[model samples]
Target: MANPSHDRDPGLVLGFERTVGDEVQAVARSAGLVVDVVLWMLRRGGWSVGIGCGAVDEPMPASPREAAGPAFVLAREAVEAAKSRQRMVPLAVRGSDEGAALDAEAVLMLVAATGARRSAAGWEAVDAVEEAGGTRQEDVAARLGISQQAVSQRLRTALYDETRAATRAATHLLTTAHP
Candidate 1:
């Protein structure tokens, strides 16, 4: 909505609100969903995912339309910045703490780019293992009708461990960015 003040939603969807600049704005109660949203958006492809973290107006309302703060402003900036990037991963982070925000963005972009390079076969192995729980490479291999060695090879090629580690680091950075 170009004028968010005039528009109101009956209910929030996925902890975000449809707002101006084509933003699904996440506010206080919905804040915890940011990392999950980013991870899911990256896997789905074709989205410029931006995260903003910082102080919100005291006693924030349930609706994003009713909320106004630096966090919302930063989110707009982050998404606009993400959209402007040409050949890079469509992801960004912005926060009251600039350094932590940059660190978060760096880690997230590295992990996203690395995952982007993963092959379809590699994703299959990754999916299977994830579905079966991280402990069972054999289960993943059997489900995918590939050898355990092949499953391991695919994960190695995909750098799954590195991605997970980077994701954790990014999440941590995001948390530190605001509070």
Candidate 2:
């Protein structure tokens, strides 16, 4: 059974609902008829196909198990999107416990934008660190026989490049929105 409380409400964001619905429809099409029935139930129960908000008093579920199938799929898509650098707004309830939930929401948005896979360099770095059984920058550098300074420089460069890319994207968005 779908949980009504877990439904997404995108509030005043026009087109967001349709965008979400399209994503659901894609998933439904992929999963065939069984999942389509689940999606239909979720939509009828107030879950937005895109962005969803939590009620001030009623919070979204913390675990995936607590969410309806469509809501879970939407959350997963949002997370992938965010990881891919797509812009998305996360829905959160108002409370202390809601902070983690909000973070989860943001993660979903990122995933929906990006994907499960990290960049090649990012994966390489992570793999190297894991193989060395050391997570610290200096330790990883030592295991790789490189100076910590070099590792730091590489990391900084990567960060700067990503920052530049993000800045350009933001600028483009602003220009398009105003123009």
lDDT of 1: 0.74
Candidate that scores best on lDDT? 1
Candidate 2: where is the Cα deviation over 4 Å? Answer: 1-104, 107-119, 130-136, 159-179
lDDT of 2 by residue, 35-141 (tens): 22323343244333232222211254343334354334434654454335423322221112334334434433333233123455543454465356547888877
* lDDT tens readout by residue for model 1, 1-179: 01122123222222466766656665533333455557667767778877878777868677777777888788878988899988568887899999999999998888878778889998888777766766688877778888999999999999988887887788788888898
| Candidate 2, residue 70: lDDT | 37
Q: Which stretches of candidate 1 lie above 4 Å from their native place? A: 1-14, 28-32
TM-score of each: 0.84, 0.27
